[model samples]
Target chain A: MIKLTYRDAVRRALADALRADENVIFFGEDVAEAGGVFKVTPGLYEEFGGERVMDTPISEEAFIGAALGAAITGMRPVAELMFADFVPVAMDQIANQIAKYRYMSGGQFIVPLTIRAAQGAGAGFGTQHSQCVESWLLNIPGIKIVVPGTVKDMYGLLRTAIDDNNPVIVLEHKVLYNYAEEIDEAELTHVPLGKAAVRRVGKDITVVATQLMMHRSLDAAERLAGEGIDCEVIDLRTMIPLDEETILESIAKTGRLVIVEEAPHAGGWGADIAALAADKGIYWLDAPVKRVNMGGALIAYSPPLEDEVVPNVSRIADAIRAVMRA
Target chain B: MTQNGIALPAQMRQDMLKKMLEIRAAEERIQGLFLENLVRGTTHLCIGQEACSVGVAAVLQPGDTMTCTYRGHGHALAMGMTMKALMAEMMGKASGACKGKGGSMHMTDASIGLLGANAIVGAQLPIAVGAALTSRLKKTGNITVTFFGEGAANIGAFHESLNLAAIWKLPVLFICENNLYGEYSVWSKTTPVRDIAVRASSYGIPGIVVDGQDAECVYHEVSAMAERARRGEGPALIELKTYRFRGHSRTDQAPYRPKGELEEWLKRDPILILKERMIADGQLDETEFEELRESIDRQVVEVVEWAKTEPYPPVEALYEDIYYEG
Candidate 1:
């Protein structure tokens, strides 16, 4: 096993995809020269040359639409959106054109395109830069949404996303890119798009989290263990075709549940999980579902305000404790 | 004007006149179908714009692709989307080209190389460029043509696509169908430039303006640009000054266009001009032209009847086309 950061794992997956398929190409703003803003595409341009690893002009619409057009004509393009908040500008192409093509065409076309976007709040970036807007994307029917919380998960999931025949939105949490973990190097590890994984097993309460929040939940679980509170942590790697069975199975075991997410509370990923549990597994619950989420408004610029707005380990632990008490 | 009695080939002149008549008669029926609520969704009829479609499409070979705008019915038909399939698409029938899902705005028939008709203004520009890029990479010797309006000419996508096409010497022909308006709004009021094609010079390419009301003139220009593209001599921007006889969609009152302007364009009605020219130039007599029109009318009626008898798609079809899975 080779130790790799989440960012390096993504790079390896991209490199592997590029090497595996002659048709796979990477294009984005600063992706070629700067090696991506997060260094996820580091040294790729040098290895692949300019034709395959294209450094496009700062035209999101052009690059995004280019990827879609390329996909239909036999090239599998992995496009980076720089940040998740910027996806709205290219939403028309994504929502109307890319997502609906195969269904609208009655299976005539396969939009085998993958868009990787960096999301979530960290590094003190203000409202325009920092956002966790995966829910808006989750509403789209045809596209798959994948969120990888760890290095290994990121590697396996990204490889699967690249090989997917449908349009896949691989949303990487900005805060978790540098987080290191053991990863297999020899070949592509396939991580299923809609499955959840258990990060830690405990009996008292099931804590369901996604992206960066999964790590925070795991840390909180470790801390809560000292207080004699055994918390079960489930990382929801893919959000859209959610691993409902895994979440429900853990909920059945613990009977208490707490969902943690970094996006705003009103319509976060947690709300969907909570609703699913409420509608299907309500009778099995020992306590009402509790959720820890970012504040309703945009993340404030000030450090303290930003910290207060985004959920961390302490808040997740508190939510788990509160759910246990309830 | 002096070419009225000029020695143009009998077959070529007759072909132009017939195509214009087909577009006019077909679109006239489309308007009736739309008004009677036989057609589904919003319709952007290209009623007065028959010349551009016949002219530009006449230039393209069978393998070349076209990206069209919302007001694209004429192009689709002219590029060989059958009258019945198009009418069924307009009626939201399963036999329609997009299986009735795309409705009036989005129509795609990849077999005939009609990529799609995008409703979003200026969005198809870059997609066409990408198609051209694909052709160049594959060494297919096929050109990609994009049909947009004067309003789209002012958008960022237009500039980006044109510049990229020129820079790469890609096989792309930009057909700017300057109908003087976008939807219910006038383009001149929205843009600073008097001539939309003038911007093409900035991208280091030729900007040719053709009489959109003249099929032969439009055909000559498009054919020349297409030849240049196929020869790998880069791209060209051709502006076809045209007009729309109807409101933008079902809801618009068309208050933005002046009454006198409509009357002036009507005097130059493309189909009528083509017929008059054909008769005067000895292409065909009035009897032969009328006989051809009747034959086309019969063909269209047969197609619509065939579509109406076709069965609807199964419910399971909704789940089938979103992705390609082995």
Candidate 2:
């Protein structure tokens, strides 16, 4: 067991993957010598050498597309997008090419491609650099998405993503990069995707969240535990192959649900969760599901303005309380 | 080596000639099927650009992989995909290359080394670069060829992919088939440079231009570059000055073309150029050319008939191919 930050754990997972397989390679802007824009992949270049670890030009479409092509040709490439906000610039390659390559190729290609990007609000990177855009890819099939909130999930899910025979995008929240925890190093290897982690178990209300919201939801659960309202917090580890079973089971136990997300309510993944609870888990619900999402605005440069839109601990707790009252 | 290209054995020349004819036949037949409402959705055809496809594929061996735009039936056929698979894919039959899922814009047959074709402009450039990255990392001694148009050179992916391939010295050939028009707009209007290959200097790599109508010229340049890349000499951008015979897609008459442009281009039709050269070299006769065309046309028609009997993929198939279960 060792104490490590979320960033260090992610770097550890990458080192493990490189050590485990010669086919595993890494590349992105400043990923080689500079570690990464977030300094999450430092020392990998020196450890693995330039052939396996490279620094690509700031061309998301090229590197992302290269990841797909390289995966098809049998090399596992871990590409970094720098910031999730930059995804739009290469949306064509990410959405059309990487996401559809396997299906379009008649299941003939095995794409063991992993793309990691720094996501969510922190460091005052503003709208173009701080948005949590994982929802932008939910509609695009043939992609597996994982957003890890803790050091454990970061290491576990990333190891799994590198080994999985598909394209997986690991959205690492910028705010959580420095989040520290003591974890058993051996236990964090190859955590299965499509499964949710029950962060805190309770019977009053279920709080479903992921990434930055996952941490806030856990905070809400702990704070609410003092008030007699017990919240069951479920951290959705994988986004695309959603762990609906866990959400449903938790909802069945609690009979009340509050969904927290960094994206706006409009066209967000939370809507899908709400619809899922309504359609499949309605019988268990004692109250309508309350969604705590970005307050219908873009993430601004100012921290206060950004806070108004980003779902936080207080907002999550409020939603849980409102659901409990109902 | 001849003035036109590397002098090849009789078998190789015959194969190139036949493949070019088959690509032309297939493109023409697809248009007819579209008019008859047989091929659903839409399709982009590479009719007059058979030489460009044939020339590139002719030099590549079985281990070499390729990716191209939606107008890649020519590339597919040249890469050894059967007429039945190509035509059946557009028809969305169960026997289609993508099992009737990808429809017309995406066609992939990996067994023949074709990664797939993408519908979006400039999306496949980075994918081929990825494949090249694989070759470099794995020391596979194989190359990847990606075909795009003049318009793609202007997109960020093109420059990004070129720079990515350049710095790493990845074994990739960026084949830009400059067909004058990127949809409705002329190349000159969209691109500042007269020669797309000249832009390769920005990445400090060699860029060569070839007369796309002459299959031998494209073959010569691609083969040379492929060899150079296989020798670990890094990537190169090759521009083939070609033209498409038809409008982009769906009922487009290409009224955007200037006066006499079509007629002038028609005189240099890739198939005609190859046919004239083959005849002058006494490698082919009028009867052989006629017989080959008739045979290819027959195969094209036969595939449509075969597809008529083939059903669409079962409804359950929709749930499949979306993810790799393992």
Return the interface RMSD of model 1.
Answer: 1.7
DockQ of candidate 1 relative to the true structure: 0.57
Which segments of model 2 are wrong by more than 4 Å?
Answer: B1-8
lDDT, candidate 2, A60-112, per-residue tens: 77788888888888888898889888888778877877777777667777888
Q: Stretches of candidate 1 above 4 Å error?
A: A186-188, B1-12, B163-169, B251-256, B315-320
Per-candidate interface DockQ score: 0.57, 0.77
Q: Give all candidates' CA lDDT scores.
A: 0.83, 0.86
**What is the per-residue lDDT of model 1 for residues B202-236, given as tens digits with 9 covering 90 to 100?**
98998888888877777777787889889999999
Quote the lDDT for B264 in model 2: 96
Clashing pairs in 2: none
Q: Write the per-residue lDDT of candidate 1 for residues A1-326, one digit (tens) a residue.
A: 77788888899899989999988889888999899988789799999988789787777777788787777777788999999999997887788778876776666677888999998887788888889878888778889899999887888999999999888999998988888876456644879888999999998899998878888889999999999999899999998779999999998898999988888877777888999899888988988898888757679789988888888888888888888788
Consecutive 10-residue window with the lowest summed lDDT within model 1 chain B: B1-10
